[model samples]
Target: MATKTAARASVESNRNDDDEPESIPAPGAKRHHFLDPRRATGRLFVATAVGIVATCFAPVHLDWRIRAVLGWDTGALCLLVLAWNILVRSCPNETQRRAGAEDPGRNLIWAVTVLASLFSLFAAVFVLRKVRAWTGFEGQLWTGLALLAVVLSWLVTHTLYTFRYAHLYYRGGRADGLDFPKDQKPADIDFAYFAFTIGMCFQVSDVVVSCTRVRRAVLVHSLISFVYNTTILSLALNVAFNLLGDG
Candidate 1:
């Protein structure tokens, strides 16, 4: 009986984890119907992720570069989905306590976030410079305005979510110990801070370039500004989608 019980629990856990955020039915609910909007949106996210992976690598004979817009979009969408999953789902009551009682997944998530932010700054200064050479800004005023709007929106979303999460946490935590309706993971805060960092760096670089007469320094400033602005542009559309969600 114990073995059968364990086996059943394992199956249930797998089923829960396998279902998409939008596709998961409410408790005691019947199976979802075909043409379900929620299921389709869930599938859409999966397909977007698959597209990112496929486009990132080219056939041996082909020379195609990764699509920056698609990649950044998938990333931002994945964050919202993750936030939804953790916020809305339930965890098993009887988790096997690890030695030292550490949450490895939480640690890894934060570490990767910090590292990604750091890398964004460095990559802005060098890796994306080549991209700018290919697609020059060309004084597109509308494009510049759009990019600034994106950064501002990200900042607002991040701040609001962080505040809400903190309130939930301080209220003796939630039933599942970490989740609450409409609450987000700490990683969102890190990403928000990352977006803010990118914006500040871009503005500072602009000022430095305008004030300095050094040609080399100006070139470097241009690279930083271009990369920071482009990252914001790449991520803006998908990040905007979060504001439209119910959670």
Candidate 2:
């Protein structure tokens, strides 16, 4: 009887030890997920940019067809990314593994996103200024490209920050992290809603950020969104006025 009890205790101990490693994942493990911003958003952005660049070189007669293909591909990929996010959220096991894990690629992700944002701004301004000299269909094409670039840049920026907020929330745990309205921890989509609100409204909407670290992240995100949204709105107005003048 004594021997059997000791044996059972030993088995349970080993089982607990095996499960311990899952709690704190190995470095870079988080990036392997399909929904990781680096893997999902990064791939989508690259594909869209490639399609746009390819469309630029296409002959005038084929330009519309190329643009049509680009639009279809971009829209499809965006849907896939969103669907995958919702699927992962529905799976408790996957969400458990993702939560509270360190993201080793964060610095690289931030660097790339910031560079893209700056480039988008510069390109939009440049296109607006140069469109007057382009004339007719060429100017319209250039303007369209700038709009696409700006939209892509805006999407990529918010997407990256959305995941960044999730990571920080999980890493900080319930005690020192974001305070969602009801749930102890919210889904990635919830974070997406939070991020887009900040991007559009420059405010925190429903979620209450609880810690300094997250507050700092929110501040930076708000500032970037402010600049990006303001610039895009101004460019639209200017472009509208230009079209009116041309008319």
How would you encode candidate 1's per-residue C-alpha lDDT over 140-209 as one tens digit per residue? 3222333333443343333223323222222222222233224433333432333343344532221121
Stretches of candidate 2 exceeding 4 Å from the true structure: 1-93, 102-106, 172-176
TM-scores of the models, in the given order? 0.29, 0.65
> Where is the poorest 10-residue window by lDDT in model 2?
17-26
The model with the greatest lDDT is 2
RMSD of 2: 9.7
Worst 10 residues of 1 by lDDT: 93-102
